[model samples]
Target: MTSGIPDSIMALVVKQDGYNPNPEGGIHFETMEPYLEFKEIAVPDLAAGQVLVGMAMAPINPSDLHFLKGEYGQPRRAGKPAGFEGVGTVIAAGEDPYAQSLIGTRVSFAATPDGTGTWATHAVAEAMLCIPQPDSVGDHDAAGFIVNPLTAAAMFEEAKAAGSPGIVLTAGASQVSKFIVALARDSGLDSICIVRRDVHNQVLTDLGATVILNQTEDDFAAELTSTMKERKPRFFIDAVADATSTQVFNAMGKDSTWMIYGSLSPETPPLPNTGELIFRNKVIKGFWLSPWLSGAALDEKLAVFAEVQARFSDGRWSTEVGATVKLDSAVETLVEALADPRGKVFIQP
Candidate 1:
């Protein structure tokens, strides 16, 4: 037990009513404020093999907003705090040696399914789930450590396993997609990147992307078809699920798989063309990080963590934080963060 740690601390609580039935077409300041509240709460008791983390920083990810809207894969209860991953200092721990050893060290942690989340000043997490951060990794980078990097690595690994000559990725300008581009370059695999604007082309090309197509261009379909002919990409990673998803799916090679990981668009993607599916042997699937990480072997999980940490240490993989907000100003800051498309936003609790 840590004698100096406070018994009570401030936290951002998400009530059941937090889900906005209509998010004004999408999540905005007005829609999100009614759902999130800041209040003082009792620190959670540490269970065996658990540690109490004094949260330093947490990012406002797209999934966090989806979770607030109650659209996530797992169910979130009322009166629970909101946040998926963050970096913090372990001030207290339970009886386990591994848990106790984490005390005084800063680590990155993902929120427990049924417990307090990282949006609070204090959060309790399983010691094994808390990966100790090296001195070289900053709080901002560490806060985003678990989600994007690991998912990118896993996606690339899966593509490699399929023995595909190259992979097609939508939302090429997103942070995870950027990581995928870098990972593919390092692995000597080609990546066909699809973005919504022409401005994103040079940046993605600089990131080692093999081909960059602007989805907004008048000749987008033509460019995509020609690129498909040259690349013959066997795997398509879809994040923006809309009409573009159907177009990309139809363009993929025969027997190719389209993995849908995120839905940035408000409208659901139209059904795949039956002719293509029946004759081309195309498949559509979903990929969620939780199950993918949970099903991974312990050694494999540790290896991924080690790889991510090393990448952060060497500046190979990183996240750009646009702004940081205190717990009290989260609502307004989140709106501002959402408006900015360039970088992520962090919460310093």
Candidate 2:
């Protein structure tokens, strides 16, 4: 064990009834106070292949909210800490050689569904799950290593593998979408970015997006159809799933693939028109980073990780941090985080 490691640490615990039934009703910090509590808790012990991390920073992500609301694919136990990915320094390790080697090194890791998470002063994670951060990467960038960046790279690889001349992406101004634009440009592929507002048009255009369509505009459908027909984009990466997805699907060419990775709209998207699905052979599927990484070979995972790190180091890809909060202010911080969708909110635990 490391010399200064504590026996107990502060953590934000999520209760069984953490989720609010009506998200539109807004959070009542008083009544909903029972849902999450900040308190001192005993530090978890390291398992055979685990290492205890002294968490430096963790982000409040959309998935974290979904998990807290009990809407995520993976269920979380009540009374456990909440957080998905973070950057930390390894304080102690189990007897395994790899675990021991990680001791005292700063690394990034995603929380296991086994109760422990990064929203604590310390967390225990499988040693192999942690990736040592290079000195060129700062704590802020490394804290988000596992989610948006990796997903952007992976989705781009999928589009490339499909031999797509171009791709269509929803939520064009999102951090991940920006990464997609940059990566797609680097790979010599074209991208058509769909956003809800004209404010993001120039931002995405500057990012190398070949086509920028504002969904709020009157001619959005016509523009999308015209661009899709001309580009023949074989892949559609969607984040906002609603009627927008159906429109994109109708615009795509035959044999095009629609990959839904996030449900930002909180409503299930309507299925594509019957004729398009039946005769065009359009495909629809979901993409989650956990399953994608798990199914990947070790070399493939390493290559992607290396590419993500290099981009961060070179300043080619990054998410803007809108705010940072302490563990004790989790409730208030979460309220603020929910109100802002423009950038990431971080917890400096």
Candidate 3:
């Protein structure tokens, strides 16, 4: 047994055996929590170069929903705990010197690539991937620090590096998009925020968005094309890949790149437009955090993480937490608690 650690860890695990995500294959949020079983299991043992995180909080993100539906990049085990990222203190560490150094530190962690989930009392993560949490950031902010904020930073940097005049964002109401909107404004670049509803307009506008377009409005197409002409936003940070993304991509002038980071929609983007590919020089690509972080330098990752912490620390950027669902009742209460998408639902012990 390890010091300051218990043998059994209680977690909300998914039973993936019989649940079908339906014939259409989109994640049904309501059915997801019912498939989860909250129970006790032995704490995962750490190997060399790993640390044991006594987790504090984790969020239920769109990615987590996709994973529960067995549609995420990683494979899911039948009884495996369900979560991706969380903040916790290192209660135990394996023999590696770097790992041992993290023994008493609080850190934010993503689940290991080997499919170890983070929704647990304790998680075994590689010491290298456990980012030290700054004292300025609280557990609520830190639990979600990695996923949305880091993606916002990386993708925004990509647009900046390309010298984009403005960035176009689909699903602008999302946490990542909100961060990007504030970033573009602070950088003195235009942020064209696209949303399905006009109700999200004020929140995004308050974040300094250059343009807000409601895809449901009748004038959306004209606004998109006109904005494309004026702002010349060639870089698209897309989260929802559907007909709307197609329309936005079509409106661009030339050398436009559609960077899809999430799949909130089930419809595949009808692509391979011979003209766009052969003539206009448009391209489409995917952004998965694991591969991106894995390929980045240690220094770059640390710099981005630190910068994100500073943003959350200040009032400039923040993720709203509507409620904190206790671990014991997470399975029963998570879905209802998360019904309002405006604020995030956090799970904790």
Candidate 4:
């Protein structure tokens, strides 16, 4: 156990009370008295190459919602604390090659195996799992930047690898979409950003998106088809998976790659047509950033931050648009944010 941090720490606990008639059943939230009252076990002792970090901030990402609802991925065996990515300050370190220099540093990173998530106040993790944050970056920005920025980078890399001229992003104006827009702009790559409403157009356009289309408008398909009439979009990344959006993908020329990464439509399940793949030579792929990033090289992961930080500092990428909430109000903030598409809910500790 560590010297000062104490055995128990204030944490969000989830338990499987019972099943419900509704789909989102079997999960519940409760704030215990305090850290010390729980099991009274020792604080997690640092192992060789391990470090103790006090989580500073973490976002309620879509996957986090799934984790909370016990829907996506394998359902947790039973009760478990949940979170995916976070920025934390190191308080102690174990014997390791990297420990000497990493102590007392704030880092932004992601971890797995459920218990090591970023949802709590303090976490003990391997030193390699922590990516040191620059002194220039604020804690809030550092926390919010980790996952979305990396996803945006990966998407761009995927598109470029396919020799695609431009990229198409569903769920435009989302925290991730905005990052994609900024990243694409900086790389001088053309992109079409799709939003569900006309109201979202100007916001994304002002953020440097050249082409913005409304998914609900009658002319939506025509607009997309006419714009890309000469050349079909080789890459389509959908964060919004609706039957209508899939229709758009179906209309694209053969030999195109459509990646489905999200399901913004609550009622519609993604149903891909087989003929497109068989006859049109099209491909439909799914992506989940967490599993893909597991076991990636440290240098490769750190590179994401270096690029994202550079863009953020230069005004090419932004983190200011999201709604910010203090740590104490975190649960309420998350509930409200999850109910609406207002913006990402950022919790500061």
> Given candidate 2, what's the lDDT at residue 248?
91
- What TM-score do all the candidates reach, one by one? 0.95, 0.93, 0.93, 0.85
lDDT of 2 by residue, 1-349 (tens): 4455687978888786534455522122333355567878887766768888899999877777666766666765776788888999998887789988999899999988642788889888889989999988888889999988889988989999999999899988888899999999998899998988777677788779999988888998899888987899989999877888888988899999999888778666678988887999989988899888789989999999999999999888776777788888876666765566557888887
What are the runs in model 1 whose C-alpha is more than 4 Å off? Answer: 17-29
lDDT of 3 by residue, 81-147 (tens): 8888999999888788899999989998888765356788888888988889878788888999899
Least well predicted 10-residue stretch by lDDT in candidate 4: 32-41
Position 299, candidate 1: lDDT: 92
Best by lDDT: 3
| TM-score of candidate 1 to 2 decimals | 0.95
Clashing residue pairs, candidate 4? none
lDDT of 1 by residue, 1-349 (tens): 5454677978788876434455422233445666678878877777878888889999888788778776777665666788899999999888899988989999998987645788889888889889999889988889999988888888888888988888889988888898899888888889998888766677778889999988889999999999998889989887778899799888888888898888777776688888878999988888889997889999998998898899889988778767778888776566776777667888887
What is the lDDT of every predicted structure here? 0.83, 0.83, 0.84, 0.67
lDDT of 4 by residue, 1-349 (tens): 2343645555444444222225542222343222101111235557777777788888767765545555565454333344567788887777786864577799876755523555666766678767787777777667876677888887777787887767788887777888877767777776788877776677687777868888778888788887666545778888867776677677677788988877656556455688888998889888777665875666776687678888766666766445665555555455554445566666555
Model 2: which ten-residue window has the lowest total lDDT?
A: 23-32
Model 4 misplacement above 4 A:
1-4, 17-42, 77-79, 269-273, 295-299, 325-329
Clashing pairs in 2: none
